[model samples]
Structures are given as structure tokens and as C-alpha cells.
Target: MSTYKAPLADIRFALYDVLGAEALFARLGFADASRDIVDAVLDEGARFNETVLAPLNRIGDEVGCVYDKTSGDVTTPPGFKQAYAQYVDGGWAGLTSPIEFGGQGMPHAAGVPLKEMIDAANLAWGNFPLLSHGATEALLHHGEAWQQEVFLKALVDGRWTGTMCLTEPHCGTDLGLLKTRATPNADGSHAVNGTKIFITAGEHDFTDNIVHLVLARLPDAPAGSKGISLFIVPKFKVGKDGVVGERNGVRCGAIEHKMGIHGSATCVINFDDAQGWLIGEPNKGLAAMFTMMNTARLAVGLQGLGLADRAYQNALRYARERLQGRSLSGPKQPDKPADPIIVHPDVRRMLLTQKALTEGGRLLGYHAATLVDVVGHGADEQERQQADALLGFVTPIVKACLTEWGVECTYHALQCFGGHGYIAEHGMEQLARDARITTLYEGTTGIQALDLMGRKVMQLQGAGLRVFLGMIEAFCKEQEGNEALHEFVAPLRAKAGEWQQLTISIGQRAVANADEVGAAAYDYLFYSGYVALAYWWARSVAAAETSSQSDAFKAAKRETARFYFARILPRTQAHAAAIGSGAASLMSMDVTHFGG
Candidate 1:
């Protein structure tokens, strides 16, 4: 089975030294998130996830979630409910929620590492509250005052869970194609009738109720996405006093039989005239649902990071212990039947690839997390808006790049385990299966790519891109004189310039032929992602050099940074070439030519 050890030191390095989140939290007026408090939170979170959640991962996968069709009830894998009870008792659910509710009111950055720990240990279990956090984001931002009082606290207090009900049988990524319907009632509420598929945590025995932030259309609504509206549909009825009451009309019709994350209850939910209230203005549900969708997008990004790091831990352990062919240089373990696998250069390559990708991905996620905190609680409107722009620019890159890397890194991890990885006993294959879904869900890489290139870059006129570019430019200038960082800094400087030029070139090509955008969208996203990570890796090396870190630790960071720069960063070259190829190659292919 897989084993997980929280990479606390690297996480701290990314948060404090590399990203400067300490100063960021202080500047944002996060008075409760002092250095001591943050450290304590990280340590405590690591202990819980590594000890309690990690052990249940394989069990959850084996037993999975059980559903009762007769009663429309779902039972989580054994030990899940108890673990969730412990999680609630420990006040973990509201780690980053507002103080007005029953929460710690910590800054979002402080909670990110804690989340990483949970997700790395057990993704299926971690998803339970992830959807809740997204729901709380929607309600806190767009819900009515009475609705906040009635439902938000329950989510914050971990008394109930939540789900983002967006996908229907007919549509997934395209919100305009959704067929869910909402009818006006005599009272203030609406009767929501829809079947939302692929609903994570839609129904579970872990909590008394589940709050579904569902999207449906009203009778008078316009066609397509503009006509959609969001509603707060709870699994159980709640009173004005925030008391749980009778069951609502919503029910889980069935759970999916999927390739992975069996521990998570991915359900087919049927809403039969469920009583729900409008979350935001009519015909503006997509906008309100975005309040939740954006949060979910980032959360899924972290999920990918968590799984990659966990897979690395298990694979690295196996490499050091499992005997194999002699190293090219010499047999390091002379006394053993064969040298350890880690002695081989090929084995080391795979291990280093995992390390480089995992650490870099963590930094990417951490930077985005800090920006989320900034956008929410920065001292001034200007700072918040700028942060929001930068966050929007990087969110797609973070979501797509990290999840894709998760798939790649997990494959490397499993490959290192050889024949044993193919077996279920070692648990390496489960990581592969779990990693597979991260790319496909939340938003597919293709969808994120289009959003990045089409909506944010071209449509917004590179507003977010300019903000991110400015930050990179400033960082590159700062490291100019430092002889030690010159190796890392020089390449980043060139990459930054190229990144901006690439955007301009794409914009020009797109103006002549809109198909240019779609043709280059995926490649452009990857190019942007690699360049973004290159900047982070450069920052990590600079930070490691200045810190009082141990020689071994500093050496590892420097070596990994070098490997990333030399090996991984060049991937941008191929992506750039693809982007430069224009739309002709893609657009010329006729629909009939797609298959024989």
C-alpha cells in the first residue's frame, strides 16, 4: 500500500521563504495568522493527515462508498464517518473560513498547506470538505443574509457538507447546454427539478445534510448561459434558526462506478421540485456559480499536487529498498544480492523528475493560494484587484499544468516500482487511477486552455497577463546582481520576455483568424505553465541559498532546480513551436477525415 509523509519543510519554504506569504498575511491584516500560529497549524495538520487520513486511504479505495437505492442514502467507506467526526471535532472544516461564522478565520495561505496534507494523504476523503469550502464561498459572497445565517454556518462548523451541482447528463463544461429547470413558487423559494451528474459529495452519511449550490434556469430566462441562475438546495430542510429539519426533495439516484476515487461518492442526483432559494440575481446564476467554480478549480489544482507528492513518497521509498540490477558506475550495495534501484541513473532520473515536478507544482499552488488571500483581504481595493487579476491569469495554468503533471509524475512513480506497481497490493496503481481524474474533472485541460487563451487573454485584452508579466519582470530585475542566482535568474529573464512576446504574437494571429486561438490554446497554456514554474524554481533556488538550511537540504533544492531548468523548462520550446505553427494544420482537417 502507498505511504504518505507530509513534505513540511518544502511546504514551509514555498510559503514563507519563496512566496513571502508571511509579509503578505501581515499586510493583508490577517492578525490571527501570526508566524507561531501558522507553524502550529501546519504541524498539527501534518500529524492528522499523515496519521488518521493516510491509513484510511487504501481502505476507502477497497470498500468504497455504499449506496442504498431503496432509501436514497449513501454510506461512506468504513472508518470514513468516524474520521470525519474527528475532523469536525478538531475544528478543521473552517480552517480558512470567516470569523463571523464558526471558523478560525485564518488567511487562505495558512490553510493551503493543511489542505495539501489532507489531499496528499487521502484525496477521496479530502474531497468531502473541499466541496463545502466552495459552497461557503458562494453563500458568503452571493447568498442572502438570511441564507448565510441559515446554511453557511453549518458548512463552516462542519455540521454539514456541500456540493457544487453544475453538471447534467447533457452537459459538463458547457454551462449553456445544461437542461436543469427551476420554477417560481408562491413563497420566496423556487422548485428546482434537475438531474446533476458527477456530483462529488452529493450524498453521504458523514454529515446530516449536504448543501448543493445548483444551477438551473427560470421560465422567463433567456437562451444559453445568460439565462441560467444559481440556487441553494439543501439535502435536508433547515429552519430559520439554523436547525436541521425534514429531508428535502433532492435525492441521490445512484453513484457512479468509476475507475478511481471510489472512496468519494460521485452521484447522480435527482432534484424533484426541491425547495431552493435564489443565490444571486435572476439570470445571473452563472456569475454566482463562478463564485463557487473558481474556488473549486483551485481546490482541484491542489488535489493534483497532493497526489503527486504522495505518489513520490511511496515510489522513492520503494526505489531505495528494492534490489535491482547493478548501477552503471558500480554496485553501491556490495553485500546485497543486487544494488538498490536508487543507485541506477535511470532510477534516479525518474525520482528526480517526480521531485522536481511535485515541489514546483506545490510552489505554483502556494503562490496562487497567497493571491487568493490577497484578493479577499488585502488592505486596499487596488491591491485586491491586482491580486485578482494575477490570480485569474495563473489559475488556469495552475489547474491545467499541475493536474497534467500529476498524471505524468504518478506514471513515473509507478514505473519506478516496476512489475510490483502493476499489482494492487503496492497501491502504486491506485495513485495512477486517482491522478487520471484530476485532469478530466473540475475542468478538463482543454477547457482550461480555452478559458486562458480565449476569455482571459484575448477577450480581457491581456489584463491579467500584463499583471503577471510585471511581477516576473520585477523579480528578474531584483536577481540581476546576485552572482549566485545568475544561473537561474538569466534564463528566467529570457523566458519572461519570450512569454510576453508569445502572447502578443498569438493575439495578432488570432485577430486575423479566430481559429488561431483554439489551435494554439492548449500549447500556449503549457508554454505559460512551464515559464511560470521556471520563475518559481528560480525563486526557490535563490531562497534556499540565503536560508540557514542544512547543507544536504540546500544541495537537494539546488540540484533539483538545476535539473528542472536543464530538463523540464525546455518543454516550453516544443509548446512554443506548436503555437507558432498557426491554425491551418488544425483547421484544414475536415470532420470526415477525423476517422476512417
Candidate 2:
């Protein structure tokens, strides 16, 4: 089995070269995010993940999280709590949060790359802090001053962890169907009563408190989603100063048994009239919750990138080490009994696919984080609004595309391992199993696609698309006359134009038939994602051509760029055809005629 190693160099390339994070950070009002600080953080983060977190991955899967029925306490896998303690002591928890709340006050973009490393090391372990980051966002945005002072600091200080309590037994994607209730009390708090399911890190022994941002309905409110309100419901009651008091009415009814990420405690949380405070204004909870949901969607995208990077690294190592047969060219490894599998063309295809997706996905994911930084901390109102529009537009596409691509890349990586990957103990199968949940949780691929095509594209009138297209156009223009970038420039320019035209076409068709949105949604998302990656890959190749790096690194990048353009970018053609097919074929099928 190959041990996981943090891909620090690739991460640096994404941050410094392709993203130009230092220059971007300085321009975006983040003077503290110097290159020296970023690199030091990355180095130490990689070390902690490699030495402390990576080794606990299999341990997490094997032991899983233990549930104590007698006390309703969920204990994480062995060494998990200790590792978290180490994480907190190192001040890693507040890397990019606000300074007043105990954070380092760096640009969120710089923290995002480091987050990718943590997820790659141990996704289950990473889950504990991931939700906390999101909760911090939600609370910081919508919570009152006192709430922020009390809850946000605890979260940022790692004294507490957070969970987005959105789902219920009957409702996964439909928030309108949620039946959780919050009754007003005389003390300006509400009594929350409901059961939230599939809550990650919902009930864990890692911390003294679990802050739940729950969605429920009030008696006097309107019907459906509009009536729902957000609440701050803790596992334990707290005083005004955030001191832990008595246990609240919340309990972990059970921990779910799952196919992957066994270490993550997916719990059924029962809130029996738990004392809670309204997060934002009543009936505006969904709007407020999005502050965290958007944070999570982007974070989940990095999960895909992280999984792909780790799988590729191990697969590449195995491909070079495992000797199988002679190369088609013959005798390249005459000293060995047989040539390594890396000499085979098919093997190269798999490796190249993994490399292309992993690297391209990083550029996309990190860029989104930078947009988030701009949205949150940009110097002026106009800049923040523009960044917000672009960020909103790409969140769904990034969430859906990266995860769908992640599963595909992990499969290819495991396929490179042959039959050995399917069995346990080799650790290849573990990564595949772990990656399966990225698309399911947060939001499924279908939901993300619909959000992209419906909410982001149609409703917003392509506001986000216009910003994104402008970026592609700007980059394409810069490379137009450069001899070294001619191949990339023409194709990228064409794809951007084709994508804009496709969006307009889809919108027109959807006007006549609403089903056209659903029919074309998935295809449109993938189509958008592929073209987006093409832009980033082109930009990356341009960076490599001019960088002061070694010849071998530059050549590898150029070769990978060729592979992506020739093999991967062609995927957009099929998506475009499918999008053009309209909704007729899908609508033609009768519901009553379908077999059970």
C-alpha cells in the first residue's frame, strides 16, 4: 500500500503561478497574506497532514466511530480526538477567519489550498473542522453581535464544532417538506423540536459543544420553504458568555452505517424542545443558511480535488513500481524481468486522465475560493458585488462538476491497480469508497445541475455567465498573438463563444418548455465545467511556458495539456449534443407506463 503524501508542490503551483494568489491577495485588501506566510503555512500544514492525519485514514475506516448507546455519546476513531487537539493547538483552525474572532485574518483563498491538503490526508478527520468553517460563515453573516462574539469565537477557537442541520427523514433536497418546528418562548428563544438526519460530525466526542444551525418552521409563518427559520441549537445549553451549562434536549439517536467515510459520524439528532435562538430574521432562514451552504458547496468541491490528487499520487506510484509486461517499444527496462506497467500506453492513458482532472480541478477550485475572498473582503462595494455574482454563478457548476469528475478519476486510479484495488488492505478501494459520498451529500449532482441551469442561468439572466465569459475572453485575448500559445488560444476562444451561444439557446428553448431546463441542465453543467477547465488548463500551460521552472516540469505540464485538450475537452461535444436534444424524448415517457 502506498502512503498518502501531501501534494505541496502542485498546491503551490495552483496558488502562486496559476492563481497568482500573492498579487491577488495584496490587491484585494489582504496585506497580511504575504507569500512568505502562505508558504510557511502550506509547508507546516502539509507536514501535519502527512505525518499526523494521513496515517489515521485507514484507522478511521477500520475502527469507524463508536456510539455509546447508554450515554448517547459518539466517540471518534482512536487517535482522532488527539489529532484534533494538535490541530487546535497549532492555531490551524483560525487560519483565515477574522482577527477579532481569533483568526489569522488571511485571505480565504490562501486557506482554501491548505484545506485541500487536509481533506486529501483524511477526509473523515477533515469533516470535523469543515462544518465549523461553514457555520462560522453563516453566523458571521446573519448572527447578532453578541451571538457572533460568543459562538463565532468558540468555533474559530476550536472549542466547538458546527453542523448544518438541514435534512430530515422524509426530505433531502426539498426544504419545504421539512417538519421541524420551533415554538417561541418568553425568554426571547425558541423551543426547537425535530429530528435531523445525516448530520456529519453532528454528535462527536471531539469537543464539549456542537453548534447546530437548524431549519424549522414557526407557527405564525407562511407555508413551505418561506416559513422556515434558522436557529442556533446547541448540544448543551450555554450562558450569555458562551459558558457550557446543562445538557440541552438534543441527543444522538443513532449513528448511520455507511459504505464510506465510516469514521465520519453521520447521526440522527433528536431535538426535543431544545432551547434555541433565531439566527436571522424569521422567515429568512433559507436565505441566511445559504451563507453556509455556499461555503459548504465550494468546500465539497475541494473534496473532489483532494480525493483525485491522493488517488492519482498512489496510482502513479503503483504504476511505476508494479512490473507487469514488456512495453510495445520493447526492452526499455532490459535490466528487469519485465517492464513496469507505466510503459504501457493504456496505463499512460489512465495516469494522464487522473493528472489532467486533478490539476485542472485544483485550478478551478482554488479560483472559486479566490472569488470568495474577493466577495467577503474586497476593498469596495462594487468589487464585492461583482465578485458575489461570479461566485454565485460558479458555485453550482463547481460543486457538481468537480465531484462527478472526482468519482470518475478515482475509478480510473483504482482501475490502474487492477484486481488488487478492489480488495481491502491495499487502501485503493478505501479512496473509492470515500469519494462516493461527495456527490450525494451537500447536494446531489442532479440538484446542482438544476440549480446551475435554473437559478444561476435562467433566473439571473446569465449575470454569472457574463462575468465568467469575460474572464475567458480576457485570457484568450492575451494569448492571441503569442506563438507558443496559438494552439490553446484558438480552441479556448471557440469554446467560450460556443458556451455563451449554448446558454442563450437553452434559455430560449426553456421558455417554451420548462422541462427543457431539466433536460438540458445536467448536460449544460458538464459542458460548462469542461470548457471552464479548458480555459484554466490553457492558462496553466501559458504560465509554464514563461515560468522559471525546470525543463522536466514544464514539459510534463505541456504534455498533460495536450492530453487534456485531445482527450478530455472532447467530452463537451457529447454534452452539447445532448443539450440540443431538448426535452421531448424525456417528456414522452409516461409515468404510469414505467415499471417498478
Give per-residue CA lDDT, model 1, range 60-177, as digits (tens): 9999999998998999999999999999998999989998987889988899898888888999999899999999998899888888988998899999899999999989888999
Superposed on all Cα atoms, the candidates' RMSDs to the truth, in angstroms, are 1.2, 1.0
Estimated TM-score for each candidate: 0.98, 0.99
User: What TM-score, to 2 decimals, does candidate 2 have?
Assistant: 0.99
Query: Tens-digit lDDT track for model 2 on 267-386?
Result: 999999999989989999998888888899999999988988899998999999999989988767999999889999999999999999999999999899999888877789987888
Model 2 clashing residue pairs (backbone):
none
Q: Which stretches of candidate 2 lie over 4 Å from their true place?
A: none
Off by over 4 Å in 1: 241-243
lDDT scores in order: 0.90, 0.90
